[model samples]
Target chain A: MTKTLAIDCMGGDYGPSVIIPAAISALQQHSDLKIYLVGPQQELQQHLKQSPDFGNRLHIQDACEVIGMSEKPSTALRRKPNSSMRKSLELVRDGHADACVSSGNTGALMALATVLLGTLPGIERPAITAELPNRKGTVTNMLDLGANIDASAEQLTSFAIMGHVFSQLADDVEHPRVALLNIGEEAVKGRDSIKLASDILSNQSQIDYVGYIEANQIYDGNVDVIVCDGFTGNNVLKACEGITRFLYDQLKTEFTSNWWSKAVSAMVWPILRRFQRRINPDQYNGASLLGLREIVIKSHGSADSKATLFAINKAITEIERQVPQAIQDQVAQLLLNTDNEDEE
Target chain B: MTKTLAIDCMGGDYGPSVIIPAAISALQQHSDLKIYLVGPQQELQQHLKQSPDFGNRLHIQDACEVIGMSEKPSTALRRKPNSSMRKSLELVRDGHADACVSSGNTGALMALATVLLGTLPGIERPAITAELPNRKGTVTNMLDLGANIDASAEQLTSFAIMGHVFSQLADDVEHPRVALLNIGEEAVKGRDSIKLASDILSNQSQIDYVGYIEANQIYDGNVDVIVCDGFTGNNVLKACEGITRFLYDQLKTEFTSNWWSKAVSAMVWPILRRFQRRINPDQYNGASLLGLREIVIKSHGSADSKATLFAINKAITEIERQVPQAIQDQVAQLLLNTDNEDEE
Candidate 1:
């Protein structure tokens, strides 16, 4: 019943300062969890001395080189062969850890994950998947959040299959409804790639493919899973982050305008704060690199202790569900069906 | 100075019901404005009977057909040559109206606008440009919002130039700062097209191009104009709209959760309502098809009268600034300079 997670302590903006505390907090919450802090031993040791029995539950794995937040994936892979990012992923690949969590450069993490764990049987590329808060008080899974741009029709269908399996585990939903992200809901709308993907997904009887959903309906939460290429996915994700921050910033500016407003703010601050917490991007920090041979979660680079802790919990849940096996079964079936049709 | 606006009254979800009322309101606000309502005369007469001396400011041009909200651009162009959308654009081309506004299918509108108005010299394609609310009170202009997808590096550079001229007119900010929208703000990041466009933009001395901007900083209001290809632009626009609406919907749900919560809402409803109005997507309804030889604005297909009226006002503003001529002059200079360099 024990789950093990490899943490890239040298990743993200805060590096070990955020990662070490987050790992300790996660250990306290999960009784049957063990963590391997992968980074320069001295940097992690400085923070490890802060907590009692920290060395007992936590293990250290030394990685000499660290990838910068903005470093190119190819260069990082070539130059930082012994990076914490690579070491953490290697642990997952070798079955030393049940899963790996990193807040490193997204491109670098994706590149390292692909090389180390490979991909699913039929999946050409592993999509980056994450849950987003929606209007229905339930979460919706969105994929390819900046891993690969211009994903082909076949790749998009693979993303839907991967997301369908992910929603079952992450959201605990049966027959998860899947939809393609587009500019309009009409079947006749969008580019040729989306149209081709729609045709392929619709033919799969097992897939609860509910046709197209526009970007404007993303948070409506009508569907459990939303699939798109990395270009649109990245733009949509960042746009949401930008608007959420803007709305709260506007409220802060409005509340401090006058004494009357300030009094009103005091009375409603608690409810407003709660609403803010629900919509915060940091609360939904872990983004799974779905379709990989092994489970690998990408945490936000700017994640603090609380966000990083949430990411750890996400990884643990993914491990508990045995996500890789579920995806493999689904992908294998899909590929077999495709092969049969090709021969005919 | 008086200005004339031609409106496709049969466009959008509400059709004549929303467009007529909105036209009356806009005409009332702008005392020196003339309106040409391009649609069936029967619908116009029914609505005009309500207003006193409606015939004084409003003119009716009968069009027997319409393009559906989801109609393909090519199909609509071929089938509905007598559509109100086409008639409205024709008014602008014939110099009968200073500007034209439509709430028809975006694809149809863009296609019609391009054919009717033609692209400016050196401009490859006319981009669908719109203003968005940002952290600062001022608006940021975003272009290529699904007018054309997969824009070349040269087209993107042209968008920046077109957007720069638009900002100077619509926003009234001289030397407006422009930035390319990418996954990351770093210079070395993004696809080849975006990188090539960024390089070209940075070299243009007159552009005030400020390198790259990621989606997270979109609402930060750091740049005056945000430029991207149609695909990313459309997705980003819809994403922001989706989040803005989602937050408001969540707030409404939260406030009505319990009697105690209802009591809290009663006291804070005024402030909350104000915030909702300020961030409403309807308030920023008009999307101008930039790079065209004449001014043509595309209103949201689902726009109500309030939003439609805002779109009318948007056309008036463009008319006052002669936006098309301004862009034409700027683009002409750049092309002539390029031609001179080739000769050298």
Candidate 2:
């Protein structure tokens, strides 16, 4: 089946400078891929003039309004009737695109996706899932990284189901081990919400629900899916980003200090590059808003061409693997089970 | 006034290898300082043999028990009657030592200190405060970084007061601006507990409460004192540590890759060392458990001699500044007002 992706061309810091080239590269690499670029037609067309196949495979949807990064998410959505993010979601809603990719305001994208594309039948909230690189060359899928801050127990259960299906479909993990993030490892430890969620998850047979996992165990590759409320997950993700930036700055200062150290630095250059490639944020770009009827990948706003390409690739993989369908199937099973329990 | 610090000799990873030398270094540097070393007599005495005036400045208490790093904190006090951590707290309780310092399990130390020295007259759980390095040369004081996992409104109010006093004593801020860590800057953005705590903090006359501060503002240097529940605080701190470690590993790999980069690295060695010193975890080694009657500093379990010495210096400073006394005065005033209001 041919896969078509709706791109928010005007989103992100570098805008078309990064996204345009990336879309072209993605289209060139993936022969089955067709991109419907959504943004200001004039600017997008001007940028597309440089590409050879701009008219052949690329389609444009005029969306003049843009959501500024600093704009209030709710107010922007209400005020800007023809924003690119909204139009992209509309394309997915109308079956013109299999997936939507944007590096725009995350809150705005989430709101637009929920309103336009709508969530899966039994899903309460759409969770954003990011794949983090583990030591064993496998990625650990973490969910609700910031889609919903205040989540109910039922929402958390939905996140686990969506996270499991995403991992299985996109990452190809069969019966993925799903673990809830808690302060402590023991099943008894954590707040009432976490404890109650654990009990609920343990009883659900559809998911391979493992016991509680501590924050420290996140990098150990012990579980395939780690789930938490948006507040905790966002904090953890930001903290990880902040620390990485801090350490990189510190190391840059260290290596450039003296002559002898610099000489030694040259000898180990290639190995270092290999390691950097392994952990680069660009390699892990594109967090998907799982549980939505259509696949929507949120790329980093500051991403360059490489990172944008990674996000586009992620969108392709989601469409090819039928991630949204898998999530819908799981949610249907959960709803049926809930109904059965109520009857009993 | 003489300042005496109770040192838990058998607490840390390397124990005496680091603690003994650090204590000696601190003593030599601060002439007014006196140390009450609590551990087994034989090992401490043998280690003290290297210092000629050890007997004159150092007093040894034969506790004969040590708390293991991995042991459950709740069981440590009752299981081992003469555990070094318990004995250290007792010294402070009996007024034999003005302050106590340990590099053992933090949970155990907090439990023992709460049970032994007790909280300030009307205070709830004592808070753990640590000074984190911000973007500027100055530091920001953060509290409840992992003392009580679940904090009530009253406990949060106490934390705010204690955190203010801690910054005044350590960071030397006369009227520190205290802020609650919340999901957003708005008062209505967080959980009910956070909203109640924010209300209480804003109304308090003693503390210079500056309203809600979001996680993004944490490194912005706007607020001098930040307070949150232990679970959230712990997650933030650990996430920071994890990210720092991740970046360090990534950068080291990046800088050591090639000859030209190594040459540049050699020239920048001194500058890099200065940067390392600025963000060194060792420089900010000690954490104070506030709201306790006696001052207690918790050092990292894997701390080296330099980190241990930093902890000792922190203990001596707290003792000299009479941190406990300041907290007592603040709590007393708060209690008086509360009692009067209740009576009315």
Candidate 3:
């Protein structure tokens, strides 16, 4: 089936320079994919002219306004009615596109998506679920990366339900293993909020709750889904980025220090490249807004052309799998089974 | 001047096996250091028998009860009156030891330290502060790594004040640059509590507040002290550990996969070892329970002998610098200023 995507070309840091090329790369990879590039017409025209792949399948939708990277979500929502981010989300809401991809202000993107596409039944707040390569070469789907801060126990359980559905659709995992992010793996550890969420998750037959997983164990790839409140999820995601950059920077400095070390570094460069490729987080650049009524992928705002391509491909995969429908079905089933679970 | 340290030899994953040897090594390194080993006398004697550095300075303080790793802080406080953890904290409170180092349940350590030593004047709650390697070959001190959850806006500013004092005293950093850990560097980014804390930090003349810092920039080492509430602190600390281990593991596996790679690895092994030593987080172990009346360092529960020695050194350094007294003075000064800081 043909899949149409709405790309927010003006949203990311690099604007048309990086995103347009990424859209071109996506079209080349998925021959049947159609993209509606939403941005300023002249700017999008210049980039499209540079690419040989522009055709009728590649439609251009001009948007007059944009949401700045540092703009407040509330302000953007009230002010920028013609923003590329809003226009792209509108495409998905109006059934013109199967999915939407944006590299825009995270808060604005989330606010606009929630207002336009609404949310699946039983999901009070939408979440941002992103994948990162783990030790076992399998990806871990961690959710609520920045969507909702101080999430309640019921909301955490809802996140688990959505994450479990994602693992099944994206990774084809049976009885997808799930775990809550905590300070310690022990039950008596973390704060009261985490303890409450544990009770809810433990009783859910639909989610294979594998107990708590610590931050150090996140990349172990033992669990398919890791759920947490937005504060924790956002910090964990950024901390990983900080450490990865430090290691690579240190290794580079070590290699180029002296002539003797440089000779050895040249010899080992290929092996190091292989190591880098295996652990590069850029390949996992896109995150789907999981509990939304329609699929919307948020690309890293600072992503390069290659990373942006990976995010677009993520959207293609979600469209093919009908991820929104799958999540809605699972959540409806969970809500239908009336269980007066303990009041958290 | 001589410094006395109380070691909870019964605590940690390896118990006396790692702690006793580490104490002996610390004694050898610091001739003026005295260590009171708190544990069952017979077991501590058996471990001490292997170390040749034991002398009059190495005294054993017997504590019959042991706090299990899984024991709850509150329960252990009520049940185990003679626990090694309690005894170590008592030694500091009674002035028998200038500082205490424990590798027990973090919650138990924090609880016992707060109850026995009490908070310094103007300090509401105690916090755990530790360091991690940064890209600049220096370390970043992050605090409240699980000691205090849901910290108020005023409490966050107080954490910054304590961390700033620590940076100056421990690292000899003059006018130490401080930053509030947030999701973004922008002033309007992060939640209400964080924004409130930022306002307090910015207006304070005593602190060199560098504004907000994101997680991905933690290793950049631009700021000396990074402050946050316990939840974000714990998650960020652990996330760094997870990513570091993953990268190192991947690099090792890549270097040893085949004969050709092994040959290249052998040539670069020396350089890799040098790089590892420079960035090894083990050297940064030993978290001080700041804001308390007495100095207490929490060693990593799974620390090996070498890591424990480093932690002991940390305690010794704090004792020499009179960290508790320094914090007490600064906090009292801040309180005397009579600012109506917005109620959290």
Candidate 4:
């Protein structure tokens, strides 16, 4: 069966410029993939016209309204009925598309996804997972990246299970080592919620639960999945981005300064490009909103064509993997066990 | 009076290897400064014997006990009498030394400082301030970097004041702009604690308070002082360090693998060195534990000789500026104003 990805073309900073071309590019590269572009039909079509002979594979879904980056998520969702983000999600909910991708307001997409597709059974909250590039060629999936700010122990446990399944399916890590992000490696060193969640995860037999991982150990690639509350995850992600930008700016200043340094920079340009490809945020463009019945990829709002194409490809992968079905089955078994324990 | 810096010679990973040489280097640069090295006299003397003319400027106090990094901080203080960390703080508390510097367990240091030196009159909790290198040449002081995990609104307000004072003293900024770290730039975006703190800071006439600062805006060099709870601050610090290390490793791989890249790396070595000096953590090694009666600089445990020397220098600067007195005076006025308002 051909996989169709619903792209929210009106979402993100350079919306159509990035999203349209990205969709066209991905569609051309993956012959089995189709894209349903959800945005202002006229504008999206105009952008798509620039690409050669891609009309057959690309479809447009008219979405008259757009969600502004600064708009309050809940208010925007309720008021804007025809928003591109909302339309894109509806396509997934109604089974018109296999997955949905948006680079707009994160909170709004989360709310809309939960409201439309609903969370999987036994999952209290749906978590957003972003792939962090480690020293190894593989990536570590970090969850709850600004999805639920105040998470209970139960919610955290659910996140771990979902993250484990997603990693196994999406990243193809067998028996993925799931860890709780704590202040220290010891199980006793964190807040009450962390301590309780650690206990729950330890008791669960389904996951290869690593005791705890500190923030400093994040780059060590000791764990396949690192789980935390949305607040901490968001702060960590932003901090990493901030430091990367800081270093890049510092390096740029160094290379452009003197004659000898410029000579050196010219020689290392290819190697630097290779390094950029590995760790660049644009490469790992989409973060999956896991535990939803349908797959949803949240792209960066400031993404260029390269990043948007990466997001579209992510949606295609999710559909092909049948990640949602795998999640649903795992959650169903967990719910059954919980019900049995309660009866006992 | 000659400034005396009490060094916790037994605190860090390499102990005397790094700290002793760093102290000697500091003395070499600043002849006016005297060093009170607190550790086991035999070990310290052995290390001191390696440096010529060290006896004239160095004094050794016998502290047989040492605080391990993994020791329970609360239990370590009550159990280990004459511990190096405790004795070092005692020197400042009794006015034997002008300032104290340690690379020991951060929790133990904060606890000992609070117990021995005590907080300023109106300050409820002490704050830890870390200097973050901005894109520009100047640095911004970020606080409560793991001093207090849970902070009240009043404590946050005081943190802003202390951070502002710290930046001014350390960075020589005339009117430092203080900003509260929040999830969003809007006034209503954060929790009640942040909102209340923002309200209190905006009304305070003594400090130059900028509005809320998002994590993305931290490196923009717009604010001289960034204030938040210890949990958030610690996480941010660790995350930034992780990313920096990751990027550095990636760059090293790019520059060393091939002959072409190696030639470029050699040519760019001068420029890279300049850039490295700008963002070097060694340049900003010490973090002041503010609100104490005496100055204390927390050096990194993994610090090299250069970083250790920088911490000692920071301690001397704090003593010279009389930062504690400035903070005490400001806090006392704030308390008096609160009392007057209550009377009305």
Who wins the lDDT comparison? Answer: 3
Q: List, residue by residue over B117-223, the lDDT tens digit for candidate 3.
A: 89998889898999877877777888889898678988998898899989988888888899998887777678899999888777667788899998888889899
Candidate 2 chain A lDDT trough over 10 residues, lowest sum: A245-254
> Which whole-number lDDT from 0 to 100 does residue B193 have in model 2?
82
For model 3, residues A72-171, the per-residue Cα lDDT tens digits are: 8897789988999999999989999999999998988889999989998788999999997898988899998988867988888889888988998999
- DockQ comparison, 2 vs 4, better candidate: 4
Candidate 4 ranges with C-alpha deviation above 4 Å = A49-56, A334-344, B53-56, B203-206, B334-344
Instruction: Write model 4 residue lDDT over A1-344, tens digit each, in one string.
Output: 88888889888889888888888788779888878999998988788676777555778999999987767777766899999999999998888889999998887898889998998877888999999888776889999888887688888888888888888888889989999887656543657888898887776566788888877778778789999988778877887887888788778778777787777777767876787777788889899999888899999888899888888888888888898999999778865664465456
* TM, chain A, every candidate: 0.97, 0.95, 0.97, 0.95
Instruction: Classify candidate 4 by CAPRI docking class.
Output: medium
- For A244-265, candidate 1 gives per-residue lDDT tens digits of 8899888777776778778878
Better of 3 and 4 by TM-score: 3
Q: Write the per-residue lDDT of candidate 4 for residues B5-89, one digit (tens) a residue.
A: 8999988789988999999999999878888899999999898776868555778889999998877678667999889999998
Candidate 1, residue B54: lDDT: 49
Q: Give the TM-score of candidate 4.
A: 0.94
Q: Candidate 2 residues A187-237, lDDT tens each? A: 544567777878778775778999787665676677999998887787677
The TM-scores of all predictions, comma-separated, are 0.97, 0.81, 0.97, 0.94
Model 1 misplacement above 4 A:
A54-56, A338-344, B337-344
